[model samples]
Target: MIENNNLVERQYEAKNNDLAEEQHEIKKNNFVVDTEERENAIEPILGSELEGLDPSNYPLITPSIELTIKNRFSSWKIAKYYLKEYGRQKGFATKRYRVEFHRNRTVKKRTLTCEKAGKYKPNKTKPIGQQRNKGSKRTDCKCHVNLSSSEHTHYVHITFIYPEHNHTINADNKRFTTAFKHFDKSIMAEIEHAVVYGYCDIHMIRNLLQLKFSDQLFLMQDLSNAIQKIKCDKKVNRSDASHLLKFLLNQQKKEPTIFVQPLINVDSNRLCSIFWMTANQILLWSHYFDVVLHDNISRTNKYNFPLSLFILVDSEGKSRLGAQAFLNNETQESYKWVLQQTLDATSSEPNVFITDMDPAMNAACKNIYENTYYLYCIWHLLQNLPKRLKSKLALIEKYPNTYEYLHNTLYPTQQSWACVFVNRIFTVGMQSTQCIESINALIYKEVSSSLSMINVVEAIDSRMQKEALKCKFYNMEI
Candidate 1:
């Protein structure tokens, strides 16, 4: 019985020895794999250092790389090329590491680092009832290539590098794995130029980019972000009232004759600015056309402010823009303020002032320019005639002259619209407020209600300049 027990113990000891040998072999294999990985990491850095050097002069250990031909302008480009070539050879994904931006948003410094992939187990234990944290497992691969500008040298330096990747390199798709890729400077410049010239539509800009850089690949979102960044850098905001006012003030300062009057609200101190060319325009109006056409366009701007345009005829018989005013409301107070500003700017009351039959506008014109004849716009009166006569249509069956009765009741006299009753000398062959209406149509073509007040003003100015050029061309042809 003792011998049987000893035999069993001996057998168990032999099995334990066999298991120990297997474990030793497994650990030996693991050590080989780790050593190989470390060697792979260090090889690329050595290769980069010895790239352009004589093979005989290649040292046992290369601490840093030295560029034989120093380039100040293309330093970043050279660094990126080296990083890209290393990524291709090493077979790992790379990304931007640390980036520094200049005040004007140019890249002052940039670093490319390996994207370490795989799950990492933390050393700390989890508390009871707490879930395990699924934190990003990016390994400390210590792989990086840094490019920095040196002001003293006036050159970009490839300051540091660890050209080693812990993760498996994607050699098959090296282009897709490159880090810190961006549009070329030339492409970015073209995009900025397009935006400044009002070709700001994203889709159109995308098409332009594709056309210009056919070989290069770019994502739509990247292009969009670039555009937004450019606009933000330019400080272009349609909603900024203060900036708009400042822009107008600058214009006024540059041109002494450009009259700009800001009406301040007593309570809020909010402003409504009226603009006009006072110096030459007033003299032109006094000498040539004594007629003034006023029209109010509502809900045509982002602010919902009623834009009032004062127009006059030039010597060439073209409809000329005389003045522009913005109002928060179509009240008598607003109209009075606008009219009073006009009177102050021009210093001459118009002989004939034409407007739509708004009671506030009519009263303001009457009170401000007592000697001026206020003629109602026939087109506007006729537009309302249909709505007013809808109920009176039933009364037309009872009375044969019902239409004439309503017309006379609404119009009161013929001098308002009828050319026969108007003074021929003052009419200048103009019977209606068509000139002002045309100006409103021209403005609406260039601007929308969604546009900021500043953009609207810019569009108006652009349209005026275009029209003036057209007029000049026509006169030259004649």
Candidate 2:
């Protein structure tokens, strides 16, 4: 009887253990089902295209990439990009949480989490009046994705994912998230193209991009930031002055007859002035250098460097661009250097040099081309008459002070500007600096004060090319 009772007790103990095991297994399966159901509940509604797809046979990752584990990427950049896209799709922002780098500066591992992943701890030591009134966006979210790479592999792989977020994911709120504000490569290319060729301001650029990409969200500040970065990238390890010099040197290489002279300061070893003349410009100067018009355009570049243009009249009675210079200052020395460069390049001097009433330029012309007739632009002189007298001129009788002032100014400068006095010198029927002023206006249309030195050079070159084409066409017609 004792042996039978012992056997019964052992059987009962084994039966209880089996029942416990069965219950535990059921609970574990339920937990897994609950977790999966929760994940499915948070997923966005699929479009009609996915209506016939089977959930179990569906690809683990979508074409746009999903927050799924074991999804390998070629580099950490790609992995992070996918994470940002995933967050955008799910109506949340993502950020880098932690990164592990190897001694060689290569990435070993990285963790990306919801932007609201950590708690925003208020600075306890802050003064009461200095506390910010804006509420914090952080909610202590635990959702994150992990990436890893092994020593033998250079490929960045998504090793793990915790795809649950404590915050509600609203598609309408996606635009407010930083992740959705990110620009893709195509958008970046468009921005760069606009910056380079479109020549539009930031607001106009934003409007154009918004119109082109109707579905994309844009902020004025963000577009400005992007434009700044694009401009910086264009420099390519060179400053504006150095890049301009390099561009001119390259141009000279293409055409051996082209002349490029850069004046560097001995004390600072910095570029102070530069002059360039293309082969075609030299050819034009060789023919039309008898009556040269010179003037300066200020504020043509970011550095406010003064751009001087030389103009000459061709046989067809049309003005042609002869040469160009960028001077650091409007001093006599700078002007003299430019005139010397022009004379050296063409090996000829202008019979009549015309310019505005600039004393420095006049002195330089007198020093360099002593035999040349120095003529002043009558239009510029008349424009300055009122300013010199400190009053605007109406009819001479109405403003007698202006008449007297004009008489005084004109009597002294008659030989320099009076058409009758200058008739002795051949001027190609040109009297004023109107041709150079027109060229300056054309340059202003292409370049702005915000442009870099290199951009100013390129814009001026482009304008010169257009003029050259026009001249060639006219010559062909003639």
Residue 129's lDDT in candidate 2: 88
- Candidate 1 positional error at 195, Å: 10
The TM-score measured for candidate 1 stands at 0.49
Cα lDDT of candidate 2 equals: 0.76
**What would the per-residue lDDT of candidate 2 be over residues 292-376, giving only the tens digit for each residue?**
9998989888788899889988887877888999899999999999999998899999988899989899889889998888889
lDDT on C-alpha atoms for all candidate structures: 0.66, 0.76
**Candidate 1 clash pair list:** 91-169, 91-170, 92-169
Question: Candidate 2: how large is its RMSD?
Answer: 18.0
TM-scores of all predicted structures = 0.49, 0.49
Model 1, span 1-478: residue lDDT tens: 9999999999999999999999998898788777546644544332344455443332223133333222222345445555554564565655676889777666788877776633366665667457666676487777776677733222355666665566544444433433423665677787787666754444457678788777555554456556656765776564346745665676677667767777766788676654555455556666654888888887566788888888888777878777777787888878888888787887788888888888888778878988888788888878876665556556766454565655655557466667677755476677678878778887887567765666566555555555655675566546
Please tell me which predicted candidate would have the highest lDDT against the true structure: 2
Worst lDDT window (10 residues) for model 1?
62-71
